[model samples]
Target: MSDKPLQRALGTTYRAEMSCGDLGKAIRQAATGPTPGEHTLREARVMQASLTAVGKEIEQQQEPTIAQELRTPVAAALADYAQDTGEILNAVNDAYIDHEDDGAWQDGKTVRMSAPLDELIDVLRALSQSPDAYADLRAAHVRQCAVGLAAVPSRAAGPTYTAPGRNCAAGLGYYDGIAEDIPDSQSKQWRSDVLQRLRNSMGTPPAYSTDPAQHITASWQRDAVRQVKVGGSGFLTDDSTRILDIWATARGDDLDARKLDALQEDMGSDACSRAEETTKQLACTREPSKCP
Candidate 1:
C-alpha cells in the first residue's frame, strides 16, 4: 500500500545481506556460539521468505532503478546460500558412498552423518512451494553436482598401486621453495646491499634470505591452521572422516565409532609416518620432507 513499508524492508535487507552489517554480526556470533538449533533454521527460512516476498513486491513498483537496487543483494544472498548448501549436500552424499564402500554403512557409521537429512528435506519442501523456487533449487543442486563429479579422484598412474594420486610432495615442495625465497631481514647481506638501501628507504625488506628455517617454521604453522579449516569447511566437520577412510583402506579395519578409538589413534600415527616417508620418497631432491 505505502512505499514506507517497501523502503524500510529494502534498507534492512541491504544492511543484512549486502554490507558487513547485521548478518555479518550474526555470523560472527554463531561462529563462537553453541551449535544452532531448529529455531535458528526456522528464523532463517522466515527471513529468506520475507525477502523473496519483498523482492516480488518491488517488481510491481514503478521506480525501475530503485527496485533493481533493492532486489540485487537479496538475490545475491539467496544465490550464495543455495550454492554453498548445495555443495555441502553433494559432499555429504559422496561421504555416504565412501562409507558404504568401506563397509561403514553396514556398521551404521553413516547414521549420524545422515541424521540431518530429514530436516533438510522438510526445509527444501517448504522452499519449493512454487514452480520458480523448484527451478532455482534444481539449478543449485545441478551446479553443485557438476562440481562434485569433477572433483572425484581417479586411480594413480603408478603400476603397483590402485590408490588415488598422492601428489602432496610436489605441492609441498613448491610451497617450501616459495617460503625459502622470502627474505629474512636479519641477514648481513640484506642489511648492507645497495638495492637493500633503496628497499629500506621505501620501508621494504631485502629480497634475499640467509635463514630460511625461521621463515619455514612460521609459514608452516600458519598454513597448517589455514588448511585444516579449509579442508573441514569443504568436506565435513569431523577432521578424522577422510583420514579414517584412508585408514580403513590401508589397515582393512572399518572404524565404526563416532570418534577415533585407541587402535584408530595408533593407525593415525602410522598414517602420519607413512605420509611423511612417502613425501620424502616422492620428492625430486634428497631432502628431508617438511611437515606443515
Candidate 2:
C-alpha cells in the first residue's frame, strides 16, 4: 500500500516461490507495521528482484510466431519513449516524498515524456495483470500518424477506422494528427514485410486457407494453369469468355483441382496425356509446395 502505483501493482501480484516468503504474506506482515527499531527493507528488496525477474524473463523469451514478430517495432518505439521519461521521473521520485503527485518537468531536464511515456507504462501495467500476458501475449502498438490528411479540415471531425478484425489484434494505439503522423498508415506495408519474413522462414502452409480476402500475400489466388493436349478431341470444347480468345476459366479461387479435372474429363480420355512435371506442376499451391 505504501509503494508507488507501479510498485504497488508489482507487490500485489502472486508468485509461486519468490525470493521473499509468499509475496502476499510479506505484504500483509509489512503493512501491519515493522517493529519500532527494525527495518523491513529486505521485503522491499525481494519484491523488486521478483518483479525484475518476471519482466526480464518475459523480455528474453524467443518470438516463434509471425504475430509475435510483428510486435517488435511497436515495442521498441515504446521503450525509447519510456527511456526519455526515465530521468525526469527518477529526479522527482528521489527528491519528492510524494513524487506521483507532481507531473511537472524536472529541474534540469527540458524534455518531459508526457502521454507517450504513459503509453508504455500502461502496457506493462496491463501485462502484469493479464491472465494470458505471460504465456501467449502478442500485442501490436500501432501509432498511426495522420499528416497531409490533417490539412483537410473535413477529415478532422470523423473517427477513422479500419475494417473489423484488422484492429482487433490487441493493438494499442497512440496517434498525432500532424506532429506525430508518419504520413502513410503503413498497415499494408507492414503486412507485406511481415508476410515476406514469414514466407522466407516458413513457406505457405499446407492448410493455408483459400480465401483471398483474408490472405496477406494473396496466397489463395495463385492457381497454376496446365495446358492439356487433345488429339482430335470430342465435344470438350474450350470456352473463353469471348472477350479474349484465350481458352481458360477465371483466374481466381475457383481454379482449383476439381475444375481442372472436370475440364479434362469433358475433353475425353485421349485429349490429355497423363500430367507430367515438365508440362505443369500441381493445380494447387500445396502440391507445388512452393508458391510464387
> Which runs of model 1 end up more than 4 angstroms from their true locations?
1-78, 87-116, 153-292
Q: Name the regions of candidate 2 deviating beyond 4 angstroms.
A: 1-39, 62-91, 94-123, 126-128, 131-292
Give the range of the ten consecutive residues with the poorest summed lDDT in model 1: 230-239
Clashes of 2: 2
lDDT of 1: 0.29
Error of 2 at 196 (Å): 43
Q: Give me the displacement of residue 240 in model 2, in angstroms.
A: 67
lDDT of each residue in 214-233, candidate 1, tens digit only: 22222322222334331111
Q: In candidate 2, what are the lDDT values of residues 101-182, reduced to their tens digit? A: 2322343523222222222232343232221221111111111111111122321222222111112111211111100111
